[model samples]
Target: MDEEDSQIQKTQLAMTVPTTRVDVLVIGAGQAGLATGYRLAQEGVSFLIVDENQQIGDSWRKRYDSLTLFTPRSLNALPGKVLDGDPDGYPSRDEFADYLANYALHYNLPVQTNFRIASLDIEAEALFWAEGADGSAILARAVVVATGGFQVPVIPEIAGTFSPQVRQLTPETYKGPADVEHGPVVVVGDGASGRDIAFELSAFKSVILSRGRNRRLLPEKLFGISMWKWLKVLGLLRAGPNSPLGRAMRKSDPFPSRERSDRDLEKRGVVLASRLIGANGKRAVFADGSTLDVGAVIWCVGYHDDFTWLMIKAAKDQTGSIVVKDGRSPVPGLFFIGRPWQRNRASALVTGSTADAQRLVDDVEQYLSSTRQGEGSIALVAK
Candidate 1:
């Protein structure tokens, strides 16, 4: 049989299985999903958390190998779990991933991995049918979309102009310096990922960091205390995106530490390049009319919010981002957690998921209560 026909047969075979029904389905088994699940457990709510990966916390594992969060172990944690070891010390990618797995095991949250929510739609009142990639489906009453941000990587279309000799990669694919090609490397976008990647690569390769937005860099420490402590004390991280402080934060970037400053980057031999404008062959064209030929290009251009799998159009705005106000969507049974600026600047960070989760769980319970009142069906979270 042809490949297409074989795939069709497989999907048909998958559809033969009965759809599992639940009161709440929290999508994405990463830190966000686990945190939300913990809250549901506290409320004794019937819920299930599902992820596309074979294991929980695989999302963090997918990042570059040398990655270490600026947020310390103590600050970034789920509702009930404490990331062990020194509270002030940063946790490496692997360490955090293991913690997530252990958190699920400790709490025994109802988590099902490798269950990809391919698409979702609401047919009956308050009901969501989340179809799996395998053609299987789940029925739920209320959905907590704790998938977190960073859904789809953003690569400029101009990258196609580069010749085959130049290797291109994204954060999802590039693991370490070994993944990069020989010769100079041009890292695009100046976000946290781009900055870290450039700094790490500078030790081994000639790296040029393509600067983007000019973010305000805060000192790692204020007085003798850590900057994180100050943010939490003054409620800076907790500020909403629409709040006066949140609006100010949106205009400015809170750099983790001063060591990552441009001066330090220059000291470490990381060339600060202008905005990336175009590319052809091995030439990386910059906005400053300067160009460089590099062996490989790492696009750290952040991500676009992808709700394509979520077939609903009621809440999504023109930019495809869900129209969420304080983590609750306009859709009755749909809610979100782990959204950047959902409540404030902290909402996107691993440290921030629990805050959103608490509110979202309460929203879910309220939604389900209404469903019960109306004898309505359940909804599903499409990650």
Candidate 2:
């Protein structure tokens, strides 16, 4: 077509994709984002939650099929809805995902699914702009980045040394032992993910789990009461970072084992090895100078925060985590929710999102009010 015809088509396409405007823009629709949206809606705030997933709770649905929440149904409930089943029973990953979807629908949360935010920047003195992957955009007075801290999978540098014949996978991508070759499997890292994977794989094939410092194990039930109930009774779950209990809990790793111990894993045919150091040819080397011949390796190390899309470098810290006090970022109008230890030790948990969102929404409303009152521009300084 001629240049004018092409220009007319471009203009029409642009016109069809309208820019959304709101008082606040939430960048995720997970537990954290939905919690904040619920609070914002209750306060009559005009806000929108934008998620990259095609449907609500797709994030949870993407996890391994056998994954079940460590937290029982009672504590796993979102802000308004309790998971509709035996409160004491654990819910599978798919069940939890469905619960999240139902929660969003029950609350009528304003969420735009399949809209991944590509970049965030200050559009003007008092407004922020969020551009989506689909060419749509949002302008708002405040922004809450509710994307949880764990956005990127973290595999160690040694992973590259493995032989091409050996299959490699991260916990995020691993579905089951069927995804690997028929030979032995080596699971790297001693975290909950590694333990769980090793436990499951042992039933099908010979499994070796690379060990680190062992984490404290809490029994699934004590005296016929769930261990979560004990944590709640001891005030450990709700303790703030400044509290003595919180300080102790933060220094400790997550309780990895529920009802199983090292002995139990050994009894189940899971051999515990020293830390995985590197790969030597086709063999997996360990810190103890030993090696294991394996057909596959699964890295359950952990995840890192992915915030490179954010235009403002001043909003992040040296470690790349968003610099925030209590969900309020160093940038005045910018906020972060669903961050680990953002306010309390429980800040990252599903049950903790409500309290974290409540405090964040309070600060967000205050910031909006100040902007409306012609206050000076928010000081966006890195802490």
Candidate 3:
């Protein structure tokens, strides 16, 4: 998922603030946001793309340095831009970040970076008002929250019970073995990230991967063909979440690691421990009642859905995730993209955003037109 942290204190100011008017306002200039912007530009919409990061693709760069996408370059490209490299080879996090930067530049898209939106609301005037910390605001007819669901790092509540001396790290903060302290490292959550971290740290520290359940390790290739190619040809990627085939996939969304497994980690000297249940001082207790000493712990437990910034109370569900059909939320003129299974299985992948963006922009266009809104215009209003 395209990830970043934009959960901050909401700036409760009036729409009277020096506001920038736009036809469509897209937040988070990540893959999903950029794709949405591209589609909006193609439709001749007066839109703006804003991101909290200093650059267009810092979201990918801010991730772990060892991060390499599971999808090859062939499947990772955004719409109209081919990722330049060995089509079958995976791109490192840095390489993908640079590609996103170049994609924005080549398209000459209007992107505003280092612009953090603290709060958003839809007023009775039929305009979306977004306030920033620096006293700037955006008033738009429609808002596309392209930021994915992965906004806040989610750790178990049991973490607070651990001793203060045990240093903790999330994938957001963890870079490499250098970040780990002396002694064994206990990695919580045996997902792809957890496995990758444990496998990498095994060479330096006595690494333990807490496996929640047995993960299926499909080979990277089948019949001498890349598994992705197989998936595409099998029509698995086109299945929507509501489809019979897609409903089956919703059971487990993580793309099973093709390379790493308990056997692979065991051979790499990684201890395959049971699910982590508790932690006390320097020892991490597992579900099997086994405890192992640890110096540092990494939580690859995943992220929380944080949309508290969107001040539309009725539009949010009990879980705080926006209630949306496809990308359109319960409220008119407010839409979301980049959510897994939002439209289909590929919705989680970067390339998947292209189709979703196109459709969502179409919906946005329809919403704007049906509302009898005039063409986008700019004006200098009194602050």
Candidate 4:
């Protein structure tokens, strides 16, 4: 087609896309999004929650099969619903997923599943636009990005060097040992995920745990009381980021297992190795210059914050993490929720969502009030 004809067709197609308008637009329907939505509802604000997945809690459901929460049911509840089960017992991944789904249903939150946001931009002062993967869009007075901190899986550069016959998978894709070939498996990373998977795989195959640093273990219970209960008594979980206890907690890793130490794992027939450095054909190389012959590799390297689709310059930091001060962005009407240390270390957990959402919704309400009163503007000049 001629250039003039193509231009006209593109213009027509763009005009055909539908646009929605709301007071607030939430970009995810996960625990963070639902928490924010519940608070928004309480404030009598018009809002909607949109998710990329077809189901409300499919994100958790898609995790590796044997996954379970480290936090007990009592501390895993979100907003208005308490997990109805053994208070001291951790819930399986599937059970948590079901709880999230039920939480949305119980609250009757307005959620549009399978609606992935493609781009977010400011159309004008106090006016924001969120374009979806589909042709639809939402124009809002305020935007809450509740997509959580875990957006992209992180695999190291050396993973590509493995032989084609050797299977390599990330925790997000690894279901169980049955998915691995009938041979030894090397699990990389020393985080909770790596240790958990290694523990499960040790029963069937020779498992190697390759890690950089040893984690400090916390007893699941102290004097017959759960560790979470002790943290509550100490007020550590609720401490502000600048507080002394909060600072120390943030510097430390999440509490590890009291029952499983390196020695314990070794006793269980799980070999502990140094950090994985690279791979040579079928051989897995470690930072200690040692090599392990394995049939499969599992990378539990964790995730990164991804906001590439967000077109606002004031929305993200140099590392692509969302920038917010007490949940409010520099741009007047834009906010971020479910970010690690967003307000406190608990900000990313289900138990912490209620407090985080409460504070953030208050900010959103104040921003909306100021904009309505002609106190300030939301126009953010691109940096």
- Between prediction 2 and prediction 4, the one with superior lDDT is 4
- How does each model score on TM-score? 0.91, 0.91, 0.92, 0.91
lDDT of 1: 0.83
Stretches > 4 Å off in candidate 4: 1-15, 241-244, 318-321, 374-383
Residue 25 in candidate 3, Cα distance off native in Å: 0.2
> lDDT of model 2 at residue 150?
74
| Residues 1-383 of candidate 2: C-alpha lDDT, one tens digit per residue | 85467446544544566677788889999989999999998988888898999999999888777888878888888777778898888889899888888888999888889998888876545577677887777777899999997788798888889888888898889998789775689988877678888888888999998887656777778898888878878777788887787777776655636645677789999998998988965799889999877898988888998888897777987777667787777787999999888887678888788888898899998989978786443332211
RMSD of 3: 5.2
Error of 2 at 330 (Å): 0.9
lDDT of candidates 1 onward, in order: 0.83, 0.81, 0.82, 0.83
| Per-residue error (Å), model 4, residue 276 | 1.3
Best by TM-score: 3
C-alpha displacement of 258 in model 3, angstroms? 3.9
Instruction: Work out how many backbone clashes candidate 2 has.
Output: 0
Off by over 4 Å in 2: 1-17, 242-244, 318-320, 374-383
Provide the lowest-lDDT 10-residue window in model 3.
1-10
Error of 4 at 201 (Å): 0.6
Per-candidate clashes come to 4, 0, 0, 0
> Candidate 1: lDDT of 42?
90
